[model samples]
Target: MSDKVFNKKIFAYIVAVVLSVFCFLPCLCLVEAEEQPSEAPTVYAADVSVTQGSGTYIYVYAKNFADVSGLDLFVRYDTSAFTLGRATKGSFISSALCDVNAETAGEIRLSYVSVDGVSGDGLILTVLLYSESEAEIKDYKVDIIVGDCYDSGLNSVAVSASGCKITVKEKQQITETVTFYSRYEDVTKRKGDEVALSFYTYNSHGFASADFEINFDDEMLALKSVSLGESLKNTDSATFSVNDKTDGYVKISYAALSAAPSYVTVLEISFTVIGDKDGQTQIEFISSALYNSDLTAYNGSKSIVTVNTEEIPSVIVYPKISLKAHSVTYSEVELDIFAEKDTLLAAGDFFVEFNAEEYECVDIVKIFDGSMIVGNTAFKAGMARLSFIYEDGISGDTAIARLRFKVLAPCETKSEFSISGSKITDKDFNEQIVEYVGTTIVVPHDFSNEFTTDEQPTCDTSGSKSHHCSRCAAVKDVTEIDALGHEYIHHEAKAPTCVEIGWKAYDTCSRCNYTTYEEIKAKGHTKAVAVEENRIEATCLEKGQYDSVVYCSVCNEELSREKKIIEALGHDYIHHKAKAPTCVEIGWEAYDTCSRCDYTTYKEISEKGHTKAAAVEENKIEATCLEDGHYDSVIYCSVCNEELSREEKTIEALGHEYGEWIVDLEPTVSAEGREYRKCLRCEHREERSVEKLKNDDEELSGCFGTLDLTSIVMIVAIMLICGVFVKVKSRKSNR
Candidate 1:
């Protein structure tokens, strides 16, 4: 028991067993920890490879999510081998609410949603795969099916699908094979012929290069040169190019450092046939290129060639004219002669020329269907000589003669039905092929009576004359002229003043300057005689105006009169009655003095004294307990300063006024004589009584005093041993 108190009581029982197992093992591991259930949203997909006709992109993903707010998959694919272009919407649903449906071409029904809730793990849809140019290259799986999955607290989101593998590749096969031909399919040139046209090709795969573009019919052939054909002329390493041969296209190019002949003959072209009415020249192969010696791209076939051209036997005769209006300006024109014969005319002779300053060959008939017969008929200057004889052998169409012309002015001519010395005697009389379709008879220049002198017959008004018909604008000679009388002049006569009215001789019309207004009769105001006088003086209150300056008894002129104010003798006012000013006053004014003319009016006299001021408080002094009182400050004349008005009088003060001493009650010890004192300026009170504080434990402070219980049990066992020695020194410094 004495080995230092047995090791301080065995270290206080090992410091209370290590503070009671450190507060009970963290409350028993938080009551057996447990909480880990979440990790449920899956949705994957991703696979694609595409090539047959290429295009690919496949995503889906959405891994361990949380607030995913909706997604409904169902993919499938292989719709005969993929082809579903466009689904897109990934970034984890930034505003989703999608819904795609490939309409059953192998199933593709997707649905997505996110009305604000899409937590974690990205990408939810991308799709778009294509591969089907005839598809069938391989692999192709793509199968993902979920149905409905959600989160944002609407729970139920536990889906896990995955499938994708497109693959499909095989797409690239051109194999080359071009062809375009024309070795004369149907050509037949004649009109100044020159034709050549070759253009042939057939390449299965041997082409190093080839490019051509040919098009014809530039107005029936013209492009005359473009060689290089003997299968590219021995292939001298074959390199040819030609571009500038344009009338309607021709561009060729050939390149072959080696292989180039699967049957070739590129181009020969060479055209001429310069059109003359017989047409046909189509040869087209506009743009063709076959290159495949490693420069891949060969697929062709184009050939169209046509050439024709041969007619030329002329026998045209024309002049079957008709004209109602060709911008009319003609005086006369008539022509008729028709004979476009391919053969069958027995006899003929022709002559027609015109424009002798615009025509003059009048009449030359012979057309009764009587089979032509109008012999010698000659004219000189404007030329016209006809001698026809058809002796009844005229086949088909006929109307062989009729000519009449006569227009000599307002001319705009073009008459030259020319046919000089022509002869046609077919029917085996041999000498036909007569071509003469000549005719130029334009007669337009008649302007019907173009007289124009619009209006010029002026002497007193009435003129109009016109004529306009440049070509049917028809309007001829509109005339009207009559009125030329009145040229009398005389002006100057004005005499009548007194109140005016006079004019008896005035006439002026030097050709419509028209003037005449005669009247003479007002002379009745002639009794004025006050040469100059303006007296406007009537005083005291206005009523004056007399201005006069008369002098026109018979026109002596000088008038300005304003009389009739004579009754204004009304201001004889001599008023003088007014005097009102009181209250300590000084007033007087009310005047009017214009007995006849001095004119005077006045009013202004006011000064009625004494206004405001009545304050008279005499000296008053009454506040005593210690001085502070005053009154006296006089001011008189509210109208006269009534009675008491002192300026000095209050002076009194004599009573208690003391301060400093503020403790009212503070005294104790057995209350022998409670003290009191007061008077800090009239709050005076005083009561005195002291002496009674001496208790020497009077009988041990009696009150039936008795028990000491062993000194209160020694101060309650010394405060319970000092609170157990300060909680055992705070658990030995917390162990």
Candidate 2:
């Protein structure tokens, strides 16, 4: 009842009141937040259509999605209507960790979370539904309902989800007919002659892939070459392959991303007649399949072609030479010169003419020589003359020269190229026949506008993508995608333990292998005790051990760890099979890893040396009267067919032996007459001019006899006029 006691009571009362008010304020604020009107995030399911027995995607979009760290959603569908294939996360929450569960028959639950809250308004999820193969074609309803949702602060968030309708329709039937046929004119071919045939597809209905297997009489025909046509190599993802390892059969497969036309030439094949006698062989299509863009097989018919062989008067068929030019880049074109396989050429001269206004020659590389031959090329305004000579006669089935050009104009511009003046000769300088085919150079801008990604960009590295040509699958317009910088989160460090080392606090990227860490030394044990665990008994072929551990008496933490060994029971030796060494691979003696541990010892056998075949002549050049001959006699490995050694030897030329000069034309007073002597070994000739019979002094002295001054002046004037007329005529002809 004293004054001091009253004061103490008043202070205690005031402290209690302050505590009560502080606690009530939080409750009041939370209640207000829960009651406050807010626009709830909307989850909308988009209406979709599906084909009966096929699958379709039902997109779930978000409209008012805002700052959220976690979400849970459930989608319910009628079990009898359709089944769920899968639920995939959309780009809206791609950076977050997501989980989908469809354990229940009629419901699917999708849950997602992120440490850093996600905020966006776009597609949220995709649900795939597949109708039963026997399900009736009708409309079905789907309800997308929201479950638990939370914000970054762990506060409850309101989310509203809507329902969608799915309409299932009957699959459409294809009525178009696809046909496969061979195109070849039945021609009479002799043994060793080449027969060409092509296979085509009609009414393909925009097919994506084709496979064909062809059979022929192996004894009568030999497969020479197979080439894919434009339709097979014209897409960004095109692939073509051929398997002809087995005799009498060849299988060709072609695929492209882009759809092909109704009629397309698929492939061309060449064969050599090899039958001993005159006979006929049928190239039959054993099996054919054409797949449309949707991977549905199209009904097709097989085809066959016949080739007849006969003996006739031998006729020499000249090799056909061709020139091809194609754009390699947006600003570069590659020109290649090719000849048929049977062209045995020693020297040749040819010219390639093009429009100088549209393209400019940049470089020319001959494939046969290591270095360009001096003075071998003569470049004029619009033409380039290419001449080459191989001391050793060369046979060709490949490109002889590759020329690079800079496109001076737009890629769409076209320029014509003409090949002419080709004089090919044998080593003996005999004129050999060759047929030249002309071609045009068109730099096409057929690259597709849509780019295909070649490499996807990672968190720290850039990626590349390109637009590919629609007709040749050539890559162009390459672009680099920027790297997505890493998203990092802090990770706390663990304290060093008595038996384990620790690391300092660091940050780690969520998307990539990027981290920063520093190790901390382990704290050694202060107090100790010893114990044993996991004891194992030794076996007939194995050793065993038990874990020996030490513990700190203060914290009961493990201080030291080791294994106490038990002696092994002697092994019962087992023999292993030995393998012989091959020409390239080394062999090993019998060895084995012990049954209890990885322990083995063996001797390595040296690789067997190459089995060399006898040396044979290669790249031989016949000796000529004027040029030296050269050849390389090489030994090859019989097992691997690799060249083992080469001995290059030169053969001296046989010098020309000329006979005595013969007077073919006697000297005349008006002009000089020539005579020649020819070499005895080859058609080598030497000629010298004979001086005009010394304008016989008697005839020359009186050549201009008894002429008046007027006549002499007239004669001089006539000679001047004639000289002038000749010069003028020459100039006109040149122009």
Highest lDDT: give the candidate number: 2
Q: Each model's TM-score?
A: 0.21, 0.23
Q: Write the per-residue lDDT of candidate 1 for residues 1-735, one digit (tens) a residue.
A: 454684587567556544555556465445534443566667776566765755666777778776778877887777776666556456567577776777777777778777777777877666666677789888877778898787767777677887878788886665555766778746567767787768666644676677677666565677878876776667657778788433456677778766666787777777777786666667676434566667776665567787878766686564221211112236656666666444466676777766677667677778646565564434677677776666655666665677767776453445555755556676456666555555665666444454675676666677666666665555655766665567778877887666778896798877677788787876766656775367776544556666667776787676566564643455566787778776666567877776676767766677666655767666566665657677887766676554434565555655665454444454445556456656556675656666556565755665334534344444554565566566767766776
- Taking the tens digit of each residue's C-alpha lDDT, what string does model 2 give over 1-735? 654675466556555655655556567667767888767788998788876655666888877767788999988987896987556677788788988788988998889998898776877777767777667788899999999999989999888889899888875554555777888878788888888989877666887877777677766889999887776677658997899865566788878887887687877889988875666778876333567778876654568898888865567767877787644665788877776756666678778888888778777788766323322233887777777676655555756777777777666566787776556776677777788887876677768789999999888788999998755557888899988678888889977877688899999898877899889877766766688878997876667789989878645777788888887786555556788898888998888655644456767899987998989999999888989999999999998788989998899998999999987788997688899999998968899998888656767667675554445545655565566556656755776
TM-score of 2: 0.23
